[model samples]
Structures are given as C-alpha cells and as structure tokens.
Target: MAKHPSLQTSKHQRFWKNRRVFLTGHTGFKGAWLSLWLISVGAKVTGYALKAPTEPNLFELLELRKDMISIVADIRDLGRLKAEMKKAKPDIVIHMAAQPIVRRSYKNPPETYETNVMGTVNLFEAVRACKSVRVVLNITTDKVYENKEIDKAYKESESLGGYDPYSASKACSEIVTASYRHSFFNPNEYGKHKVAVASARAGNVIGGGDWASDRLVPDCVRAVLRGKKIEIRNPGATRPWQYVLDPLNGYLLLCERLYKNGAKFAGAWNIGPDLKDCKSVGWIARKFCDYWGSSKTCSIQKGKHPHEAHFLKLDNLKAKKQLGWYPKWDINEALSKVVEWTKAYESGLGVREISEKQIRDFEGFPQLNDAELY
Candidate 1:
C-alpha cells in the first residue's frame, strides 16, 4: 500500500484498520493488488503463495515484502500451511491461489484438481485448527457456472458445473467451501466455532500489474509493446469484463459485513460489471487498441483454439441488493486505464506510484459511460 492521496481514506477504514489477513496467491496479479490495497487501508497482511507465475510481477514492483510477511510456499502442503496459519493467527483469510489459466488446465487436468480442490481442503483443515481466523473468503471464478451458450446471466444459486478442467476444479472448490461451512463451521453452532466462510465469484478482472499469459489484457499489452498485431480468439464470445478493483472492493465490503454480522453475510457471491458492459472480445480489443494509439487492427486467429464460453455474464443483482456493490468503472474506462498503465510502464515511471494513483482514481469515482462497448 504505497501512499497516494486518493487511497488515504476508505469508507470501511474503521473495520480493517488493524486487522490481520492471511492472503494466499499474493505474488500473482490480483493477489498483489489486494495486498497493496489492504496495506493502504491499514491492514496487516501475510502473503502465502508459490513463486510468482510471471517474471516481472507486481509483488516485486511494489516491494510488498516491506509491508507483508511474504512466505514462499505451496498451498497444497497442508502441514506447512497449518503451521503458518497458527503462527500468523490472522483475523481473516482470503484464498486466491490456484492454477487459473484454462489452457494450462487442459494441458494438466490433474495438477489443476490437485491445486484447486485438494488445496481448498488443505485450507479448511488449517482453518479448523487456527481459531484466530473469523472470516474466510475463497475467491473462485465466473466460470464455475454451467454455460448454456445463451445471453442469460448466471446467479449464485444456479447449478454449479464446469466445461473445462480449470472451471471444474473451481466448481469443486466452491463445493468444498460449502461442505466445510455446513459440516464444521455451521452458523447454527456459532457458539462452538466462531468462523464464517464464504466464496466470491468475479468477472474478467482487468487492471494494472498483470503480466500473465493467455489473458486478454496482458496479451493486448504485449502485442502493443512488441509492435505486433493484436490477436483475437473467439471474437464473438462475450464476457463480463471489469476492472480488478471492483471485485476487490466487493470482497472487502463482504468481509466487513461478515465481521459484524456473521451467518447472514456468509454465502456465495457474484462481483461482476453491469450487464451492458458485457461485450465481445473483438469489442474489447478494438477499444484497447484505440486507447493504446495502435492503428493496427486485431487479427482474428484462425483454426481451432480451446473451447470457451460463447456467452458469459454474471447476475450481480445479489451483490448489488445485498452488499450494495456496483462497478465504478465500465468497460471502456477499464480499457483506458489499461492503456494508461502500459504507457506509464513504457515511460519508466515508478509503477508503485502509478498503481497507487489508479487506486485513488477509482476511489474518486470518475465519470464513466454506461453504454455497451460494442
């Protein structure tokens, strides 16, 4: 949490000011952003995850080791995770580590299940032992829903199914979270164990400090940097694209509500952009190129690629009506921020400073259009 003028104050400041958080996958894109935001909000964070998936990472860029107790370990190692949990005695736990790439999951299904499913079990086992933790938010993906290839948005109560190995593993993760809640941490038996657990499903989160492969935003950044024509796969497929911080805000708010009111806030949630912003990949690439000052149009990749959802959106009415969560930035604005970040990176600006400023900008709630990007 590098200091910026805008991140100086948060609405939930009183709740998270001194809370201790045990965060998994802090080395990755969303993890790094969440860790920084927590620090900015005056929270103590202990990051537990494997070595960063990418070379140039946000964790190193922001020097997060100074703010958090960065631990390099595997989530699959239950003994090690339990020891760390006991040592840290965190007040809250956010599980974000997983084999997140769909293509990679296809390449190695066993690894995905081992890391996503068994790894979830290992986390709950650790939670069972460490009573210091009161709230646990397991971060899953929008792909947990069974895609019917229609324009209909999926709700939290919808049937849980997955088309790909990655999606299936995450669906399993959700099931594991539910089982732990019903079996061990039942709210009716709140007197026995005072822990509340919930799972969060988010749309396509785009933000700064992401340099992963097979992701649309990072792919666009790399193409622009290398002067290559942006490549588009399944251009007609639509997705619920949103800025990363939007979902992060939902997660934090949910944690705050759960801390004060236990069982009522504990359940599955969806943090997605407005329905109008759910646009096709071609629209995203086109908007991104316009923002990045690239005249080169997107070149649609020919031939068969891995199967992906032709239409995917999330019914965020639950989070909106329940948690009062809404996306501050829309799709076009999200793409513009991505361009701004890339420009800053190319100009050799201190990314820590720029990232902090972006967080502040979102906090300021700058004006953005509600129209569909298409």
Candidate 2:
C-alpha cells in the first residue's frame, strides 16, 4: 500500500485536530484502532465501553487507557452512558459498541440483542439530547443486508435483513439509526444543530492486536503461534476482506462529509475492498500461513458449525463517488502487515511501537518522533 500523502493540506486533518469526540466501544478491536488513530490526530476522545473481553485483547495490549478518558461501562447502562456523553459534550459521536460476531450470537442471542439493538437505541437517545453533538456515525456490519446468495454486491438501498442474531441486531440498529435521524435530527425539521446521523457498513476486517474468538485471522495467528492446526468453519465462504484501517478511514471520511454538508451525505455508505479482492476462508488461511511461514494447516471444522453467509461483498461506489474514499491497501499488503505485527510482537518486540509503526505506514505519516509515542 502506498502512503496516503500527508493530510496536512486536507480538511480532514484540521477537522480531526483537537476535536472533542465521544467513542463508545473503544475497548474492542476496531475501536482500539480508531481511538489510537484519533489520538494521533490530536482528537480529545472519551471512550465508553466495558473492559477488554479477553485477557490479551488489543485494548489492553496497546495500553489504550492512557491516551483517552476511558470510561469502563456497558452501553446498555443508559444512565451512565447518558451522563458521560453529557459531561463530555462531544462535537461528534461514533457508536461502535456491540456484540460483533455471528456464531457467538447464536450461542448468546439475548445478550447480542441487548447490546447490539438496545445499546444502539440508548446511544442514539443520548445523542439526541446532547445538543453539542453536530454529527454522528453509527457503525454497522455488511451482514445487515438481507442475503440471497446472489453474486452481486449489495447496495445501500437493498432491503435490510439478517438471518443470524448478530446480523439481525445490526440491521435493527440500522433501522434505529435511520429512525432517529429522520424522527429527531432531520434537517428539514430540526436543522443542522440537531445532529446529522449516518450509518456505515464495513467489510471483514483483519489486522494485528485482534484476538477475538471465532474470527479467521486471529484463529490462524493463534494456531500458528501455538503450532496447532487451525479450524476453518466455512472454508468456501467468500468475504470482502480489507485491513481494519481501510474502513476506519472511510468512517472518518463519512463523518467529515456529514459534518461539512448535513443531509447531502447523510445516509448509509459501504466500506469494503473491490470484488476481485474478496477471497474464501481457505484461501485466506493459506495466505496467512505462507506469510507467517508457520507449518499450520486449516481443515473444515467437524460436526455442526453455525450458519454463515457463503458469499458477501459490498458495492462501495456511493462512498467513492460521494466522499472520494477508496481502499488504500490491497489484500496481500493487508495480510502481510497483519503478519508482520503479530510476528514482531510474538518475538518480544515492543508491541506499542510496532502498532504505531503500522498506523504511520497506513496513513502515510512520517515515522513518529520519540516524543510522539513509544
């Protein structure tokens, strides 16, 4: 991936610099990355989420608690979340806190609905009351779309449906976002200060520091590191895979556009790699093993595995034409970078330094000075 020329000239830099933002779920994999990136750009971020789920999750590994006002609370706790947002009085809000898994959802359907659906509702209610918030972005998943096993990529206008609890919860969250946007923050009624809302659907993201269970990349990494054969649930399932930062960049870009032009860009946008980059689980595992040079092998899990979509992809034309957003890294580079970070950290190198280096590489920023971050 080529460096994204310095944002020094783009309004994205100035817009993000020193901005007061409320970020829920900063303890999760993608949230940790977003929090770190926001801090790097000088955003004053207040993170609200429960403690890391796993012992060695990215949030704890990177020590993200030091950089922001880390609020260790569940999003379902409306009173606590509301008070935090009120006190923070953020200029923007990004809701990412949720139960983000498919098979896990089947295992714990009620918990998934409570977090993904009710949690989103609570966040939107809080945002509605927080007058200081000018723009909001609710992060959903590509699974929010109703899948029919068609070969074509899904567009934003497609019907919203999900066969699994996790996907359905996210689809419900999307509805809640749209309902709140139109019912509460509609520019035609409440005007711009009411807070513009946009939802983003991202692809299957893989990167370092993600140790979540039931995920392909993390499972591969763990098995490789442990000299165990990785288990593949759906080897033939094809997904639009991209580096975690790719969709994150799109989210930031979406926020910028919504902040600048209220209703013009206020809607759902898809963030994913091109269709050709989409690959099967077996293919991804082989590539990861090749990059790590670990002799780990992957075989389809025996017995029952939860149902997952066989093929899924997102059409990103809307975001590209409207927000001028495009994926920076291809699959090869994305996987290589992930392996690079995992290997470096596993080798007893400074994890934080390696993470920051990858971040700099992704954003095209110059290597950080010693004083910036270690």
Candidate 3:
C-alpha cells in the first residue's frame, strides 16, 4: 500500500477554506463530528436535519447551532428540502440523514425505506434544483454489500444487497446515487452539467459522543457509567472497526478530489480499516472494558434478536490508492480515545475542548489543549 499524507494536509486546507458546504444529519454522531471538522478547516456549513436524535447528543453538547446555519427539518420533505438547498446555494452537498439503526428498521420497515431510500431521492431532486452545487457525496454503510457471511472484504464493484431493512434501504440509496450520477450528473457530460456525484461506504465507526442505541461502543459506555456489565448480543460477529475521524477524513478527501477532478472521481468508494482491525463483538467489548479501567465487564445477552451479518468488512484499497486516504487510528487507539472522552464527560470536564483536541491530533496538527469553544 502507498503511504498517504495526514488529513488536513496543506493542500486540503487550501481547498476547504471558505468553501460552502450543505450537510444533512449534522445533528447525528458522524455528522456532528464532520460539522466540527468542517468549521475548524474554514468551511461555511449549513446543516439541515431533525433535532438531535438522542438526548445529550453531540450537536447540543458542542453547541453547534452557534457556529453554523442549522435547519430543523425532515429529509423526506422534498419541497422544504429544495427550498433550503436553494437558500443555502451551497457548493457541495453531503447527504447523511437517514434511519440508521438496523434493529429499529426491523420494527418499522416502512419508515426506514421512506427515510433512507426516498430521502436520497429527495436530496438529488433538491440538488437538481440548486445550480451552485458542484459535488454531492452520499454516505452509506458497509452493510450495503450482499453479505454471504464470509471472510472476504467487499469492494465497490461488488453486487449490492442487504438482508435487513436498514441495509436494503441503504442499498437502494446507493442505487439512487448511481441513477443520479448517470442521468443528471453524468460524468460523460461533465462539460454540460459540471456536477459530480459519489457515494461513500464505510465500516462501523466508534468514538466519543455517540449515544445511539444498539451499538457496541455506546452500549459499553452506558453500561460502564451505570456500573453494569456490557451486553453482547452477538459476541462472535466481526466488523471492520475504525475510529470516527478515519472515515470522515476519507470523506473530506474524496469530496476534495471530486471537486477538482469532477468526472474522474465520481462513483462509489469504500472507506474502512485494515483487515487486521476487523474484530469480533466480544473482542471489542473486552478491549473497551480494559480501557475503561472499571470493575464493569461484558455479559452475553441471551435473547433471540433480529438477524444481522456475522462477518462484515470493506476493501479500502481504492480509497488508499486513488484518494490517498488511510485509516489513521487502529481499534486500540480508537477505544482509548472513546474512554478518554467519556471519562472527561463524566467528570464534568470540557467536552468540546477534548473533541477539538482529538481532531487536531488526528490531523497531525498541534493539539489545542486550551482552545475551548462552547
């Protein structure tokens, strides 16, 4: 593999400075981190999403509304979405709003499809109306692949399939991105439209400030805080785990490439950790327990749960070779950071300061230990 430069590399800063970015789902975990990163790099961000999905969410934790234009709305509302896009007149669009939980999808499949599939359609429709938009990056999951429960990692060219409603909905979302790319933002006609469209598929991302349900790290955090054992539903299932900033770095790098090269960079790409980091649920739980330095531990939750893939991973060679993006933090470093931030929050220390420091550290820049923002 080729050596890749650190994120926020000098050239990237030049590209992102003063750039207009329209980001959906900025209230969510990954979105909040990306929103903060964008702001730190000098991007003018307009965030559109429902209110923070979880109480004590990162959006409110960071007080992000004070930093950007935040619009509280549903992704399915085409008219409202279009009006907002028109108003923002953004140069780049990043679609992240969706019904992201897998178990929740099994409970309400209709809402899942409506939000993940049709919401994607509505975003493209809004993009069609907004002429200022030159790039659109839709974030999807690594589960979009047709999981045969094998050890092989999935590539961007592999067949798209999903056994669960959430996975299936994201597969449909990927198809929607492809349709838009071919029909509206066709690379062959780059001269005519001057718009580029791409979709990013990333593996399970763990970090601080995620309060979402049914996830490994959040479950561990909650259990540890309460001095209870962490519940492991599927102890043996393995996933390509990387820190949150690793994949977000890839997203920003891809966006920059798509903006400058246009057609050449338009398509689906996978951003994930190295194969060695694909750890089982039990392994992650145990490691996280060790990092927390608490008496709390892991306990297998015995119950018939809805079906989920036993083994999942992504082939990140394309991103590494083409975009010069690489996963910076391994599972160990990731879990340590999560524990560090969670403990700081529990001790009533400054979270925004810790979060910013993490970003700076990840970018190979100077850590802003005293750079406090509320």
* TM-score per candidate: 0.96, 0.93, 0.95
- Between the candidate structures 1 and 3, which one is better when assessed by lDDT? 3
Q: Stretches of candidate 1 above 4 Å error?
A: 1-6, 366-374
TM-score order of candidates, best first?
A: 1, 3, 2
- What does candidate 1's lDDT look like per residue over 1-374, in tens digits? 44434665876567888899999999999999999889888898999999999989888988888888999999999999999999999999999999999999999999999999999999999999997999999999999998888899999999999999999999999999999999998988876788888999999999887999998889888898999998989889999999888899889999988777888888999998889889999989988988887796789889989898899999998888888777888898888998888799889999888888888888788533334223
lDDT per residue (tens digit) for residues 22-89 in model 2: 99999999999888778767788999998877768888887777778999999999999899999999
Q: Once model 1 is optimally superposed onto the true structure by TM-score, how far is the C-alpha of residue 124 displaced, in angstroms?
A: 0.5
**Tens digits of per-residue lDDT for model 3, 6-104:** 334534578887899999999999999999888877788999999999998999998888778999999999999999999999999999999999999
Q: Is candidate 1 or candidate 2 better by lDDT?
A: 1
lDDT ranking from best candidate downward:
3, 1, 2
In terms of lDDT, which candidate is strongest?
3
In model 2, the runs with Cα more than 4 Å from the true position are: 1-12, 190-192, 365-374
Q: Give per-model CA RMSD.
A: 2.5, 5.8, 6.2
Cα shift from native, residue 187, model 2 (Å): 3.1
Number of the top TM-score candidate: 1
